[model samples]
Target: MAYKALYRTYRPKDFNEVAGQEHITKTFRNALKSGKIAHAYLFSGPRGTGKTSIAKIIAKAVNCLKAPTDNPCNNCDVCRGIDDNTISDVIEIDAASNNSVDQVREIRDKVKYLPGVTKYKVYIIDEVHMLSQGAFNALLKTLEEPPKHVIFILATTEPHKIPATIHSRCQRFDFRGISIPEMTKRLDKIIDEEKIQIDSEAIKVIAESAEGGMRDAISLLDQVVSYSEEAVSIEDVHAIKGTVSNEKILVIAKSIAENDTVKSISLLDELIMDGKEPQRLVDNMIAFYRNMLMFKNVNTDDFEQLIYKNEEFQKLALNLSNNLVFYYIEVLNKALHDMRFTTNAKLYMELAIIKMIDKIEKQEIVFEDTLNDLRSEISSLRSEIKTINTQKPLENVVKNKEDVPESKVDTFSKKIINDSETEEPVVNEHLIKAKEVIVSTLYSKDDIEEEVPNTVEVENKILSSDLTEDNNVKSEEKDIFNTSLQEEKKVDNIVKYKTFDIRFVEDVLNNGDRELKIDMIKKWYDLDRFATVDDKPYTKMITEGRIVAANSKLIIIEYESAAVCNRLMKKDFKEKMKSLINKFYNSNLDYLALPKSVWEEKSQEFIKKWRNGDKDIKLTPIKNSELIEIEEIDDEIEDMTPDSVKEAINIFGSDNVKVKRGEN
Candidate 1:
């Protein structure tokens, strides 16, 4: 005889012989004995759980030499012939291969004929859900009203794919996966009957590796027997399956509990070197941790009931908290899922172990201790600031009294008089330096003139000449004055006629309408105007700041200096700004504040873009034309004037400026 595989050689020939499906087998036997045979039958369940075997057994029982028998006697010629696939009356079809409409139509053509040898003709279709829609429709009519002599048995692992019409027309039996214990009992029987030398532990391992499939368990047993010359041991099973031993898994778990990342990673590497699958290693680790968690939580009496009842597990559970166990399980489960798609499975497994170690270390550092340290640092900072505040005014008063030049006395007196209504006087450092320079120049003017005799002689000659040509000199002076006046008027006209290009205005309006933009700007300005620090308004910090541009969710404000921009960038200030916008507008908006120089540069870029006629332009006509007239006179003056004049403007307002030529 040729060699036959274990699963095929030990195939069930009778309903009673099938393992771990007593619910279905018992019902079938009763149905057979009662002779309540249906024209069509459906058997559905997980793979290798006896759906096909039971289907074959039902065929045999129905066409037995002795009619309507619950158990087919394998001794009978009819049963033997059907079992050997030599019977013409019994047909076994693999629906996966012959799942087409034409094939079903062939079956429909044959159902009308009577049995050739047996009492009844039986057709067993395995994997019936593989049938095409057309094939299913073709079979529907035959299945609903089959001949009295024809019996159809449809078997599938996935019955949900079968149409509801077919399901309703047949007698359905659902089979379940064999339990571990049931599978083990059957393996023990098979081992004894086949005279196989395998220990109980080896049998248990094979049973678990099969995942409740008896055929798989028996096949694994056969492989182990073939691999081992003598008695099959647990080591043989583990080697055949490429699974890590419980002892190795326990060691890994212990290393993880001790937070020894190096040892855990080394053990994992050794297992992979020994040909243990990376995914299997992760699965074992998850199971090991799950067992430990169970041991930690379950009653002591139930410890033996667990699959991993060992001392190492108990010791590890003692060291682990519930939270750590949960985190470990979560990491391993995620790694297991990731292993399927990852090309470098070993690296992923190693990373998951490292993460577990990191989590454990983090849990050891209490949050309260960190918070207390931070509070202490903040308190020390406050004390230092308070000391500095107490001494700053006195130092300032002494410095002011000592540094005041005689020439600056009148200017300081005027400032004091002008600022009487202010709560606190703000001293300008740059102004004091300017006043000192002016006094030094006044004291050295005569010496400078003595040193530059040629320049003085030239001026004297020009003055004498101008005295003689009085009319010409007067007309020249008038021309110079008029030129200055015209320049001033031009500056005023430029300020009054300031306008933004249409493209730039369109970009702003693209974000939102003009009314909405103005409203947002007003709300933001109010927020800044009312913001205070220590009962003093923050408005002082941004004295010359104003919103330069507005869009739906973006508002650009220009500040006088980078110092104010930096202040606004602080986290506390930003949070306050966001809070006010969200509170009043009921919307979140992004704000940007730039120094005057940066704003001018950006505005120039916008104008350049407008000039280029970029295709991205999408313009909305402004309802209020005046809104496009940006009040950018200050920016224009700053850009057009010389650096010295700009600096003077910075020290004093543009409105308080005068220009005069001195007499020789």
Candidate 2:
């Protein structure tokens, strides 16, 4: 006897032994128990999912000496012979190598013969999609109407390639990939029986790396056991698979979050040098950050679902914001995509690391700048408080009673107290009370004095100064108002544009008139002929865009350059182009402009939605009023009657159009 691979040594012997396929197994058991087996069966799904194993099991169960039993009695001579492949009744064919009309004809001829040992003959063809067209034709009638004692089982990973006529004749059983938990349990059974010492996490790692395939998982476990000196570990699995360990991934992520570019690149170089793949490293990093984002958003105690479940990783998750985690995932995902096209994935990974660090540093700088601004504001507020506290009191100004009128001083003090009581309540109660105290102290009854005589000159000086200040303020305000008015008029001339509404684009794509679009596209080439020197640049802008969609009322254009698209979206440019189209094509149509890349993306989405028949996504017409800006020219045009329309146009340099008196 020779040593065998773990997957082969532990192949499922019966329906009960198969993992994660209870639906198919249970159905087959019932069919076998009732003796209602189909003559031909088709099994399809991903590789390593037990399609072939289940086919063999069905053959054994149906051919068992105890004829009507669901489970095979392995002790029977017939079952024993079939299991060991000594029996001529069960035949397994690899269609990859034996895919020819002659080979299929031989099977078709042989299927008519009775089983040598068992009651029925079973012909199992694996990878049946590899069979040629001629071979399928030859096998069609035989597979459709095989002998009463014959059973034909076909299995393929790609079911789509199988002919529909063949598919219609057989009972199809789709085998799904085994889940991680199920694979883990099966591997544990193998490990226990073989008495292989291994860490539980190592088994988990192997299961995850297998990617929903039990055979691959078992094979990985075997390789790890062979490579290890003693107990297998998670590091062993990562090393074998060229994947980064959770700890290393955590360190790299922390380095990125800390903006330690040098350390991150150093670790990346070390990993790549140690035979870890750059793409795999990027994938693991992305997974790490994705797990972090999940941990940040979801509240669960199950650490098994996450790649990194340590306390330090949790702390990192808390420290990193959800937005930053999202950004990290985005960068790494882009790197993963870019790495597939290039040979030098190391450069892309380094660039991605640098980008992440740059983002972190920029965010930190912005935070520091915000902090400095807040500090400056607090300092200014404190300085204002100090200035208010040091101001001279009113009593000091009124110490010379003859220099000021006593009745006037009493009136000023009374006004201050009255205003404080009637004014909006101050948020700070202490400030309000402080003003009251100062007013009461200044207007005390004990400090009263007689009114001074002949204060006419002082009042005249005060009145003259006040009048001069008022006149200066009024003159300044009038100048500012005129300047602002002129600026506003100039700004209004440059018509402002708004971002294109995506809904309008969807409507145009779904309901556009193809003939109208073609007409506009043909007319678009002749616009250069009408271009004068002044309007040539604008005409060129319109001509460069491609008309993507159009109807009687609207036309959509796409420009390769975003800047050109934005310029064409301007109200003035749009209006000028619309007028040109109307004049030349005799159609009044509004224009919508989008960048080429944007149109491609939107068109793809629209096509997908259409294919899915998404009733929830319905298109509605965009009113021309919503798309167009009706701007009024506020700049005054010279008033003219119909008689002087030519003179007015001449004076305005022949660029202005003559308007009727009432229209103006």
Candidate 3:
């Protein structure tokens, strides 16, 4: 007599009526037909996938008046009573609410009794994974060897939470999400039966929004129908869901692809003014780009799979390269992620759009290409060095300095011979050219001033003196020159340690020793007082930060603010901190500074690598003495039952490890 919601009113009555999941339904029918029903059944999958519905159907089929029938006779009194909840033989339990050892023990105690006025007794426990550990233990024995007349059906959205022991005893059926097409077809039938007027586009909008859940689709349809007294339109669905229209999304994507920053920002402002959420807009843009990418790659004629038609997708995809499209997707995805923690979502979205346009414009000057060029130059230099080693000795030319006229030698070589009186050596032409290239390519003017010195004069002095002297002096010059060259190499290595970014963090996390890193962090924290300059405690300024990762040579520290980072970036402060760190470790180590936000991003990236089973990103085990001591204390406290001991362990990590004893 009362009006019911569409999902409830159209609940599937049998296996044939259930939408999707025919694999599970067909198996149930076959098992029922052959009279080989399983004692315990576990249905697990995403929500609204018919796990509970299939459980109810199986119950009716087994308890139907017609013995061992695949289809339940709904017209029969036995089926009618079960459907009305009047039959005592069938019981439905919500394990989420009654998830306790006592409740499970009650079920185990009652499972031995035979069904009354029915062929079999069925117990359906929904959200069974919510049951406590003790409750699962209680259910385990009964589930393993249930009475012949009793049938247990356990259903959950997350099967991974269920213990393997329970899983081993049950026949598990995984229900999959309903497809969009399947959902659309079902909605069409429902509209036709209900005599409701709705546009096909509106049905599609609801179906896509449902995200592969029939119940959700039906509920959305019902809500939209209530909102529009007449035929429902796509606009109504969009307004109800607070989503931007596909046409607006297309326009935004087109603006980005065309590098129209002004147009993109203006349209974004309009959307924000019109109550469109910034995060939602970002998500829609990401989806639009993803669909364009699919159209570019997948040669499918099915327009249903795409959000836009083929022609529209073609026009957009043609204007964008696959690499650019991927880059846009990554930018939008990052914006979407940042929107969650950011207070000004609209500002972030606007900046994201600007960045996309900037990236597209600068796509010609890719960083990867720059790195490749650097690599090529380095290889060329290596080859040049090898060539120099095989060439005729310059010593012979210098040995005949007296035979050649003054004008014969070049001014550059004459200057080297004249400058030999000074302690500085004249660096050879090859080494000078190499130094120029390194400075030009890798360092700025200020860095070059600090890096390469007047070593050329020093080299020239050694060569000139050695060519005009005895064997002992020549040998001494050779050793002195070799020492100077080694020092230059060390300076080059130091230049390579500039500053770290996300890539460096990733590298350290993947390849750096974990225990050594933890040890370094602990030592840095302990030696904080010594890291000070000009009476300002650099350590205190950096104490708010943390060392997230480290290697033998480099330690990555993350600070909460730019001020702290800037303070630590001071030359004197950095030197003092580095000195302190070296003192503790007894080895030269460098500290890399990063913002907290950047650290969080890199940490998430590293975690994803770990999850994907990346061999390079191995998670380092925590084996520091401090942690070991805490663990030992925990083991000792396990046997203590006093409330004081429990509270102490909970607060101080151990019952016996106290900051202070009682005064008495």
Identify the leading candidate in terms of lDDT. 2
Q: Say what the RMSD of model 2 is.
A: 18.2
- Model 3: lDDT of residue 245: 77
Top-TM-score candidate index: 2
lDDT tens digits, residues 51-163, model 2?
A: 99999888898889897988888788888888799998899999999999999999988887777888889999999999999999999999888999999999999999999
* CA lDDT of every candidate: 0.70, 0.75, 0.73
Tens digit of per-residue lDDT, candidate 3, span 90-148: 89999999999999999999988888888889999999999999999998889998899
TM-score to native of every candidate shown: 0.56, 0.58, 0.57
Candidate 1 has its poorest 10 consecutive residues by lDDT at 421-430
Query: For model 1, what is the error of residue 102's alpha carbon versus the real structure, in angstroms, after optimal superposition?
Result: 0.8
Q: Using lDDT, rank the candidates from best to worst.
A: 2, 3, 1
The residue pairs found clashing in candidate 1 are none
The residue-level lDDT of candidate 1 at 237 comes to 90
Which portions of model 2 show Cα errors greater than 4 Å? Answer: 289-308, 312-330, 360-664
